[model samples]
Target: MEAMVNNICDIVLKRLYMPRVGILWTSGNHDFLRWAPSGELTWVHYLSGDFTKSSNHANNPCYIVESLTDPYREAKTLSALIIPNISLDFVSKLCLGLPFTAAGSLVFGCLDEQLPVIVDDTCITRWLRTIDPKRIDEITSRLCNLGFIVISKIGSTSSSCVLELDEKGWISWCEIADRLSGIGVVILKNGSRLTDEAEDRLRSLGIKIER
Candidate 1:
């Protein structure tokens, strides 16, 4: 996992160039992402002590930095790299001795669905509009083969969801169902099909299904 984290940091460093970047993470869950300005990878760091301090408080506070409306926009405007859904422990490891970087509060649960998030155990995902889609597919495929179930949207505007099934199949769905709660759509891909039982289950929870 450490090796994967290092490789992901290397990818971000090679692809982005910016003065500062924001790493956003939620408490308890520890899911995190790198927020960058202009959707490009570059130099990044936390802009304030708010996020680091939030880790100690039960209720996370909000603040304004870099003249933005709020911390989220500031991070978005200044962040140059993103790695999503990683553990807080890895966040520390990723920032150790790194120049111009800081971890901050996400201020909300989950990333903006529009971003192409890499959902995995290590939170390594593709970023930047200029990044090759084929390369993203390659990484997604490799992770799937290794028994990691990936769930992401089909496109930025689409209401549908895409489920990248792991090698062990749908057995893991129950484990991840809570994460899918309140989600409104699901779209199966790569010859994957949801069993009628599963479909009914999702619908019972108010999730819509699309072929």
Candidate 2:
């Protein structure tokens, strides 16, 4: 199960592109600073609202900072650290308060900035096991019965399932469409092949194929 969780993390990381450097907002004192790389922490006295704006203009800016100290005082001195090469491990450690629960949302919320952020693997695994567990189990069982060796859910939505095919042979969507009733998207990995008939069948059934 641990191996499967890590594999899913790898798949999601590969599909999402992130920047090398990112801004991390924190209200914690310097005690929580060890998780970050040396000399990367920068204390800011004032941050213009413009700094919160991402490269893409569509993302709404969020700047909430929770602190144990005086809320008004702390807000003025919130530290916005420059994180280089951010990873799941770093986030799991540094984001001490409600780490796993809020980490995914925080990362996804900052997509427009191309933040070097990723959803913690434990968080993803927990969601998979907790949210609609029976449905997930049924889906896995059905997929395995259909000869799928690798399967994982990448998004919270029903359509976010991914199935990796063996590098060797072509697969026909007609052969598996009925079994995949709730799945709306399929990502083909490792140079997997899909016949023209499969493509047509999948599209006709409102299933998207991504290679």
Candidate 3:
């Protein structure tokens, strides 16, 4: 596991072509993609299960910002974690306007759908624009750039997508799983349907899939 982690760090550093540092901090069940403002890898520090509790994760300054209000915050990393059982009042306290580069927030909406828990639209937009097929789910329609290798047309009535991955897309499926793992997102795609081989692969890579 340690060797694999180091390899990923190297891949991100080289592929990004930036001199940014990587901070790897393990608090609960998530790993953050921390980079410097100058495009340099700094440190990879893990944090608490709750993203708002920066103090628990080495006093790192974590802030939540909305993409609609702060679009510039969506350059590189994904937004905050999905705080299950968190209330609106607690959300107000957590998002009390901090100065750190806002990663956005996830909220529970009225629809009661299995949504991506993100409150701000920025992270969703960033995810959609990404070329990684796994990252390109049909949940959000804001930035439909995820239709590169596999086009997922949004249905006005259904939240689920009927997927048919191309050979090329299937080959790069691991990349999507890795990206999601790095960002701490556990999204079950294709209505949670998958072959035993696919499930085993994702599990070995530390990517969570819905059973």
Candidate 4:
């Protein structure tokens, strides 16, 4: 009730010439900061509003498809589908010319899982330039199943990135080390220390850690 009253009061003040000022009201402080359909991702947001049904928009549709009732929604599409939960700030940066494919990977692959993830959009921009549209649809659908929301681009897209190994990446390194057992092992971690799992795997293979 207080929120409603504040919203009404804000509207009245705006009509009284608040001048170049506006605000968003959500249930929480984080939500208030996140909703930015106002000016962020101008084209993408507009297309979603213009395309999605009024009813669906009211409910904050989870998947803003090109057509809600199409039989082959998985095949072709007009605009990149978006999930409404993404921060408006993120959408704004994306619409400002980030690699759509890499952004898809970053948000769905790393960010959605709350994993410690980093990205270099510049590298992805060059590495993946001509991905098949069907591949994108496949990736998008899979990511969605994993509780991720994506904005997909049609036609060819490009993205590739490689991040430095971090403490969190050790488990993956261990898995790799396990596979290298038959091929003989040479540990080459410079200043970085091995993850416990990595050390265990190498030791199991009778390899000794100098460090």
Winning model by TM-score: 1
Misplaced by over 4 Å in model 2 are 1-160
Quantify all predictions' global Cα lDDT against the true fold.
0.39, 0.40, 0.33, 0.33
Query: Compared to the true structure, candidate 4 yields what TM-score?
Result: 0.18
State the lDDT of candidate 2 residue by residue for 1-211, as single tens digits: 9999999998667534322222334322222223333223232221223243322211212332221223333322322123222333434443332323233333333332322121212232445566766644554454334322212233436434544455557887545543453455777787788898767655744567887
lDDT of 1 by residue, 1-211 (tens): 9999999998677555534434333223432222223433332332243344322211112222222335445445442323335443443443342212223323211133122122332323324224554544554454334322344333423442333343334533444443441245666555566666667656644466665
**Against the true structure, whose lDDT is highest?**
2
* Model 3 spans > 4 angstroms off: 1-61, 64-72, 90-115, 118-211
lDDT of 4 by residue, 130-171 (tens): 544354334334443443323222122222111123333234
Task: Indicate whether candidate 1 or candidate 2 has the larger lDDT.
Answer: 2
Model 3 scores what on Cα lDDT?
0.33
Listed per candidate, the RMSD to the true structure in angstroms reads: 18.2, 18.1, 14.8, 17.9
Off by over 4 Å in 4: 1-175, 178-183
Task: Tell me the tens digit of each residue's lDDT in model 3 across 1-211.
Answer: 9999999999666745532222222223343443223223322232334555443223233432332244232222322223322233333333443324232222222012222222222333343455554543433231112211111122312323222333322333433421231232234544445456555544643345542
In candidate 2 the C-alpha lDDT for residue 32 amounts to 24
Deviation in angstroms for 164 in model 2?
2.9
TM-score of each model, in listed order: 0.28, 0.26, 0.22, 0.18
- The C-alpha local distance difference test score for the whole of candidate 1 amounts to 0.39
- Model 4's alpha-carbon lDDT is 0.33
